[model samples]
Target chain A: MLNRYYRVQAGPEGYLPPAAASMGVMLPEKGEALVEGIIVSEEEAMQKIAEKIVNAKNPVFFPGPNILWAWNDSVLEKAYAVNDLVQSSGARVIPMPDYRPKYPMINPEVEINPNHPNLTIWHNHIDVCVFVGVHCHYANIALKIIRGGTDCYTIAICGEAGHEDAMISLRDVSIDTLRRLNDVIKSTGEGLK
Target chain B: MNKGLVKISPCFEDVMPQEYKELVEKGSYGQDYGVADLGSFKELIEEHPLCAGCGLALSMRLILASLPNPESTIIVGSTGCSALAFSQVALHNIHSLFGNQNAVATGLKRALKLRFPDEIKDVVVIAGDGATADIGLDMVMQSWFRRENITTIMLDNEAYANTGGQESGMTAEKAVLNMAPKGKNFPKVNLADVAQVAGCAYVATCNPAKSRVLEKAVKRAILAAREIGPTYVQIYAPCPTNYKLKPDEVLATVKNREKEGTYPTGEFISAKAQELFESLEGGSK
Candidate 1:
């Protein structure tokens, strides 16, 4: 509920707080931002993220159970797509090693750990952490603590907004939204740099 | 550290894999090792190096015999005496970490279900009391809470029999064991009661020495997991070496515990499971 930039409010869905509305995506057809909360479209969310992806110095991706929930049928394919885009952008990916070592890298990875302290160790180094479809309970409140203590920016793509941790929350997104985000980054990423 | 290893193998260099291969090639020595033909058509387990009158070993044999479909069942074992004989059993088995049997089984069951979808593959967790009720209790309880379609069998041998008879959480109150010089101070964990409250569709406590009760409990646990949610079967197994009793007195120890009202043997089926089972049974008939 407590965030640096975004304000929380109830929506028809869980909670829809606009992600990167300040990034200036002109949407005359979708209407202006509401008094309740700004409703950012998937295309706008992807475009904003694309700019960040090309300009990122040290970005990290922490994918969670939502990835499994969204891409229940083809989890491996979606994970590989996300991994390829993140890795190509020179981002570090970490997963809960102890519980499911093969989960983070639905394909394969070199390192894994359940404890989130490994993320805290690189406090000053990491500029942004992209949490795609992460649940609230999985990380032991480490996400909230990490955002509260450190200056690292976070972008959460999950079922709802008001995730306290993420600076820009693309709330109430489907599996296609995530895939398109990766695609946008893959295509327009070269132009930004 | 190497003293015990040396004693088990006096001339370890000569104990080669070729010797076991030749013994298998002979093929006529099936009945030579005193394999019991206890009215059963087939034997799922083979002779192992467990001590005489070992109640845990007997419990494992009874459990293996009670599986509804041995070919489709996968046993996930933890570190303990039972793990030593797991390799000897003629079935699919996995020995993960000491207290991670339930966690490993959860992932395996979910993954298997996703892959197969049509076939019913039974995934069972078979481990000692120390692995289940003590160290791995959180994982076991969490799996049950999540309603994982799996069966868990805890061979309750009172103490940590595998690790030099140390005191475990399942150790009975006022009983003086290895680590508890004065007394255990706490009562034994009634895991059957815990399982019943934790949403387990089937829960039972049985003495392995009573072969019929243990077998029935194991079968029900497996069958109930398919229809209902998770199931748990706790077998009261006694250790002779740790209890400082004669090899023939292990069953007597379990009997005394049951008689003293410490470890009662009976099955506890949930209401939903009972209804579903009876309907399925009636329809089949």
Candidate 2:
């Protein structure tokens, strides 16, 4: 029998609506629990990441398939805007391998999978890694690479709840949230100057 | 601020920044409409890597130029030799995974309509026969069944030309190909008739060598899709590399193959399409 399977539905990352919106969660009835957290709101986490970036010597940003999931021209512009906000703060932004990057921060040699060849090279030196809209599975692998190799701080900012190991799990992921976060960072950074 | 939640930028018009409105209207989201001069139209398609006299390339060029509203049209492609030429095509193009252009187009069309209800956006899928007829048959049928407003054009080169010319479901019987060393055993899948039966508002089978007929069929298909729902045009494009024929022989192969129950040309407008066309004509008059 020929099996024709296409990903008609979005992956875990695709299920996220904006943080302010209510959505029914789809859970597996008979599997090990996938999500566990301290229940911090998404906004507080963004502020903390902003503070961390302001203080940290080395910070890296990893963005995932959320851009592709949105798939609208306007959505793309928004994604780029968020990237710009992070970039202006002097953070090294890396795009998910599958997603086309607006900037050249993503190491094309490194893929999103666990066994990427460049993962070993980036495993140790970074002080903090801020994950924005990365899939739960990839986020876990990234944690493994960073935690196993360095005493690095990890933060997750996402629409859905999954990254159990993140020091701060900011759960609200919507474009509105990014806009507010951008405003705060822009003001604070400019205030310091 | 929802610090715990990581928010991305919103592209939805309601949430997107105001400055982007002008960008969307200025054809930044899609490609410019290349010149429409017949016989010697300026090429929207730059030089491509396809073999010389590749019928699929010719058909794509014609279809790209015949989009009717290239500025507002988004072309979705799937994995095939046809997709290889997409990078060079000036129009806003997307290459989704193999065998899923229809599904992608369905989502894209619906999204565009939702975002711009006042504007007319054309979502067209141009894919190879294998993607449309074999692997993507289910999605293609589903889109037609849903009556999605989109146009799908299949550049049918008979076999799976990109993957070393393997025998596809659309491969003609007795045609020897990679996997069918002893000649293909089954007849071509009746995709045009399938589209007709599946309630596609307009269906046509044309060849690139007959540019006028192909262009008319494409134009009609696009126009019909605006009001009459899904439309399909399957062009009999030949693969010279796969067919083991000289580059110049591609046109003749499509033209002469009709005697063997292949490459039938003409339009098949459903009753709904006919009604829609009449109403449009009446309203204009």
Candidate 3:
């Protein structure tokens, strides 16, 4: 059996809405939570990060869809070995699925979840119909088969250290990769875990 | 077609006929004839669209209907269904790139002011809360700071409906919404407050599901941006896909949100930026 498992840099910040919204409770702002740091406005900043990704000698990985959960230690080990194997086979190692968690105090307004899930599902509220599962039965299934939004996932390099994986939030992605991943997940019904 | 009928903009009318006036006022017709005649228009639209269905169609129509000129409105959008849909529309209309919708609209508005000072038009920045609150926050601020005459509408469908229903700033924290970091734990940085402080002259919120409220808010934003300067408006557009409910529930959700003041859905006249819009009549504003 494949015994599918996942890695966790941080867990998907699950069931966090009301506690975050309530007064006196200090939760991360929506903006601060999505990315590791304040949004980079200057091109130089993005360039600097991009350069880091390109220059990293170590293998790169994709973060989970969210911040709270990433993967279990065992699953992550498999992934790291896979990366090493792929690299040894003479395939160019791509720095992807890197995540940068925001730390509090230093960048206090939005703090990082020190303990998040293995597959931190990095979803977006603006586009992918978050209310999907509860409101409509066929939406995800129908949308998944078509390779629509949230149907697939990918990898990026933002804050992964060594074999540790993380998802870097890129503004856009390649459709080919998206379609391929969707096909795999659609077949399994596991949702890119 | 009824023999006594005189066509007036599909479902809406110019003047009320005594016999049919009540039917019209009572919201008789839901579908329209306008959609049929445009050959391959539906097919073409269906090509790249993300199944937003009629809601998005009417949304663009309503926004484009009063465009001083669609060509003049240089749209700036971040990555969302709205952006993709706008890209599809741009095939026929004049549009700029994806993302940076607010930034582009700001520059376009400034260019219009500098080049065609007297041309009363708009440069709309179409977007979603995920873009506005999460990614495009700074862009919106800078546009207002520059005092450019443009309008940016941040359509809040609660969650990040495009990249998979994740949490957004506009999504009330822990409202049983999506996979958020901690839900909006911190008080939402009141966007209107931020705009006012940033020197915006007008800010408003509306749900187009309520056509009158939407039209009124949009009209105000357009006027403010054209006459005075840049403005911001947030629309509570619901996402059944994310919410996992029927599309029509959007109206009820929006209404409840409005009543609770969780989502501020009204035209706000900011004192700074540029005084374009008249202070809404009375204190009712």
Query: Using Cα atoms with residue i matched to residue i, what is each candidate's TM-score against the true structure?
Result: 0.52, 0.57, 0.46
CAPRI classification of candidate 3: incorrect
Q: What C-alpha RMSD does candidate 1 show over the true interface residues after superposing them?
A: 21.3
**Residue A176 local lDDT, model 2:** 72
Expressed as tens digits, the lDDT of each residue in B1-285 for candidate 2 is: 011112223422333222223334432234334324543434556467788889998898788767777757788999999888886664668899988899999999999889988888899999999999999999899999999999999989988887888988888889998767999887889898999999899999999878878887888799899887999999999999888989889888887976565667878988877787677656331
What's the best-to-worst order under TM-score?
2, 1, 3
Question: Between candidates 2 and 3, which one is better according to DockQ?
Answer: 2
lDDT of 1: 0.65
| Regions of model 2 farther than 4 Å from truth | A1-52, A55-88, A92-156, A159-169, A173-193, B1-58, B61-65, B68-125, B134-148, B162-164, B185-190, B193-199, B209-213, B245-264, B270-285
Please provide the root mean square deviation of candidate 1 (C-alpha atoms, Å). Answer: 15.2
TM-score of chain A of each: 0.60, 0.62, 0.22
Candidate 2 CAPRI category: incorrect
Q: What tens digits encode model 3's per-residue C-alpha lDDT throughout A42-117?
A: 2332333333333333322221222111234433443344333233322222111112221111121121112221
Is 1 or 2 the stronger prediction by lDDT?
2
Native-to-model Cα distance after best TM-score fit, residue B33 in candidate 2, in Å = 1.3
Residue B107 displacement in candidate 2 (angstroms)? 7.7
- The candidate that wins on DockQ is 2
The predicted structure with the larger TM-score, 1 or 2, is: 2
**lDDT tens digits by residue: candidate 1, B130-241:** 9999889999999999999999999988888867778788888877766667878878888889999998999989997688777767877888898678999999888786
